[model samples]
Target: MPIWVTEWALIDWFAGPDYPDSARQGEYAEASAAMMEELSIVERYAWFSLPYWDHIPSLGLYHPGPVATPAGEAYARAGG
Candidate 1:
């Protein structure tokens, strides 16, 4: 199974909260698509399963709840 875990403090250390939302979305889309593509390949084919996504929005990490982020949308498209 694939999973994406996010730690706010770790992200803050590398890139402050000031990081552009657009840039983050772009990166999220790229990452989500890459993961999906990898999982879709015959060489990498495996049982399909919804990716486990963990992030605490209260702590600043993106949440795939009420509001869907690019990552969440991509995951949905991948049949999550």
Candidate 2:
């Protein structure tokens, strides 16, 4: 028998100036939820690529310290 694993990212890098809004609007979350719902039928799992992706200058990866973003809230509500 064999097992399969996968990972995915939800950021819209090509959104350019609207990247922030794109990330916060739950669009990615909705997509993730839909994918997960489909995967659920197959008993598969999905991993979020990054929880906190912001990189600060000279400070390295930025950790918001357990804060929840609007997208995160929507994701949870979507059963993600």
Computed on alpha carbons, the lDDT of every model, listed in order, comes to 0.40, 0.48
Question: Candidate 1's residue-wise lDDT over 1-80, tens digit each?
Answer: 55543221113445444333534643555565556566633223222122324432322223444555554454446554
* Cα lDDT for residue 18, candidate 2: 32
lDDT of 2 by residue, 1-80 (tens): 33334554344557652333534445665676666666634345444433555641111112267555555655567664
Give all candidate RMSDs, comma-separated. 8.0, 5.8
Cα distance off (Å), candidate 1, residue 51? 15
- Candidate 2 wrongly placed segments (more than 4 Å): 1-5, 11-25, 39-41, 56-63
- Candidate that would win on TM-score: 2
Residue 25 lDDT, candidate 1, scale 0-100: 43
Q: Give the top-scoring candidate (lDDT).
A: 2
